[model samples]
Target chain A: MHDIGVRETIRFLGLTFNIETLKMTWLAMGIVILIACLATRNLKVVPQGWQNFVEMIILWLHDQIDAMMGRRGRMLAPFIVGLFMFLLASNLIGLVPLMASPTNDLNTTLGLALLVVVMVHCLGLYFKGGHYIAHFFQPTPVFVVINMIEEIAKPITLAFRLFGNILAGEILIIVLLKLMPIWMPIPSVCWLAFSIFISCVQAVIFTMLSMAYLANAVKEDHAE
Target chain B: MIVLIEINATILAQILNFLILVVLLRAVAYKPVARLLQQRSDKIKGDLDKAEADRKAAEQTLEQYKVQLADAHKKAQDIVDKANVTARQEHDAAVAETRKEIERMKATAQAEIENERNRAFDEMKSQIVSLSLAAAGKVVMKNIDTKENDKLVNDFISKLDKNMFADLR
Candidate 1:
């Protein structure tokens, strides 16, 4: 359980890097890129096989984004879609023998959450300008402190939600394997299947929340 | 104790990796597929429009041909009717001319017959007068009475009827 919190570090050019999470992240990214390339290499007006599958997934994601953010949400589709894909891949890779899930790491999840938060704020500022900062002072001046704290807690909540779910699933599977080593295959398989479902749900939730945040930030205040 | 909460280079590295993945995937996959879909939709719309235009043009051409054919049929009928009327008029005129010529020949023949009959009647009358005169002379010469013979001749000539000689002339 302590190993879940500790990352194996590698020193290169006097900079400390988390070797395990970086390796797994790169591996997941490479898999996604390779599949994407193969699917798009011989693209036709009519799709087939993997291309058909990938296009369906992309269309589904686009619809989800559209539902969340209206027509303007299309601009954020590739980023949101990429985030979902990467997280889903990272989460599912943990089911493989001896492979650690990158999302199980607090640093990785926090980094992704911070990225989404930064993008939301930047987009809000770009779209709403000074009116974006004025939203925090709404209803009364006394509620401004509460609104600021709530805003600050958003990214922390987003990060921990994914990290806790994935890390807990991984730790439970490990404890199950340790306790029942002889008859562990059946329970481990069931747990793995359940974990896979959880991974998918967590990925979807993360993407949905990110889209919702972006929509809220960039949306024009209709109250006026 | 606070080491777990510390922000480090690993977080920065993950951010970089995520950004790189997003950029790469967007470039390689999403944009091209979306563009292809849009292009296919446009092409389909264009093809449909062209098909509709072609259909309308064909319909217009068919209508024009029908109108021209109807006009030609009417003109041909008119020409046939006019020829029929002209032929009928010419036939009637020829028949009228033939009837007039036959009437004129009949009138001329009647007049010639009348003239011949009149000449024949005059010759017969002269012959009768000569015969009567000869007989009178013989009688007169035999009996020796000239006044009585002349009176007898005058009475015979006056007693002849003009209507009785009409059939003979």
Candidate 2:
């Protein structure tokens, strides 16, 4: 079998950019968004049946956001909640027999990490103004280099952390399934349970970290 | 050298695959899901607001009812007290009229008894005088001598004078 790693997936088109992963990511994003929209199109206040269940999930996410982010967290509630739901859907879709998790690839995680990094910087700068950049010097001038390196490393580490976890977990599950045919049912059930739990946890952690980073930036800006 | 090139190509491929996934997810999943969630949140806030307003109104209405109930009870009690007072006054007036009537009857009966008693005393005195005059005329007729009759009349007059004088004092 092919190594099936991220390196094998990249290809350049002229001087512009890569194309395949973008298309797949977009497709996956589109399907789930469409489904979510249709599900909540007609919202009744006292939700009945399916609508009630969907609304409950949304409310639950809001509560979690409130708990983690506080009152200011309410504003970011929709974004963070939407991110988790979408990620969970994407991850679970990968578990389908013929499909693969988009997150199992480094490129997908990198894009998500890039988005988070951009959001964090934008928020931090907005709150701190020009002084936000000055935080790099921190305790001493020599720390400036260390801080800069850490800043640069942040996206790489975050992206790889998620990618590695998802890829390794998926691989282990697959290998176990193949090895124990007699105990196939057990592994399948365990994999499903574990994967779903991990997927949700990862989504929460990612969103929480982004919020924390932004909050720190804003706090620093106000302090100065 | 060939292995290094292949490794680079593989990395590139994986990156492309991931990019496609993210783009697809953003367009198809995130947009619609976010919109739906926002709508649901707004709806919940609205319901909560409505419930609060309704509760406030209900409390106000309850207060109004309590006031009205108290007022009604006061009015009922006032009517009862007024009726009792009116009945007491009527009873007192009836008793006073009965007493006045009884007093008037007693006064009239007393006046009638006093007039009858005076008439009886006057009749007894007249009867006694007539009997005494008759007896004196008889005695005069029987005596046959004028001087004797005169002496006897003088003695009777003296005796009457002494008795009358004593009675007058």
Candidate 3:
């Protein structure tokens, strides 16, 4: 129980690696890859079994991206779908005994958020050129600072929202298991069930926010 | 909170992980799946078009057969009519030939009857001339000249039998 709060930190080439988070991240990646392989193997024109299941999830994600940015977001589908699978697996993995969620680590969540934000700006620059950067100065120079703050807050909120929820839920579970003796299994079980629900909700919220941010970058009309 | 948000190499590693995953997954899954779906849709479109063409060809062939059937019926009817006309002509020609033969037979029989009656009348005249001559010679032996009596009897026979033979004719 004491070891639950501690991460296995490793030093390699003068850089500290959070090995525990890395291990869980790799496990999540393996799950994602396994699912991808299963879905794509022996693929029939008429889908069945795992192919049917994976197609349903993928088609839903595609519809979301398509609805958000229509045809322009077509290229972004792979990255978006991959991100969702990773997030979903990372967030839910903590529920298994002796395992922890990779998303509970701030580094992992921040890394994902930064990746999305950077890609959004890159896509904006690629599609719209100078207007992408010029949007921050719209409605007069007075609004530049506000727009800049809004831009900075986007990734911060995106990262912290997911990290905080997952970490807090895991921390509570740990707390309930270790200290709470008044009402033992009831609260712990309830919180665990609730945390599972929270994990799913948080993953979906992250994915949706990322899509929305990306859509804004490639939008038809610049509303800034 | 300060310790938790520390910038470290882990963030870089995680980004690398994501990038590698994307590349691998794209190769294994996305491109192939999209292509397969496109292939199936294209195949369906081609099949449907071929089916429509086949249906149209079958219909055209059926229409041609129907037309051919109708023509055959018309041709058969024409053959029957021509045969009937030829049969009627043959029947009429045969009847005309039979009537001509009958007329010729009747004409020949009547000519033969006329020739036989003339021959019988010639024989009777000869017999009657001989008998009258003999009878007159016996009756008037020394009373008249022989040469004069013969002339008188011949004149009498000619006068008496003249209309009788005419009536018989």
Model 3 alpha-carbon drift over 4 Å, by segment: A1-4, A176-193, A219-224, B1-7, B59-70, B87-169
DockQ of each: 0.31, 0.08, 0.32
Q: By TM-score, is 2 or 3 better?
A: 3
Report the Cα lDDT for residue A131, model 3.
85
Q: What is the C-alpha lDDT of each candidate?
A: 0.85, 0.64, 0.86
> Which numbered prediction scores highest in lDDT against the true structure?
3
Model 1, position A55: C-alpha lDDT score = 84
Clashing pairs in 3: none
Compute each candidate's TM-score over C-alphas.
0.72, 0.58, 0.75
Best of the candidates, TM-score: 3
Q: Residue A166 of candidate 1: its Cα lDDT? A: 90
Candidate 2 C-alpha lDDT tens digits along A1-224: 12334222333553222233344445566665566656666655446665665566667866765555556655555555556665666666666665566667665676667666776788778766767787777777799999878777877877777777777777766777767886458877787788878877776676667666545553433345
| Angstrom error at residue A29, model 3 | 0.5
Off by over 4 Å in 1: A1-6, A181-184, A220-223, B1-7, B72-169
lDDT of 3 by residue, A139-219 (tens): 788899999898899999999999999989888888888888876689899999999899989989999999999998876
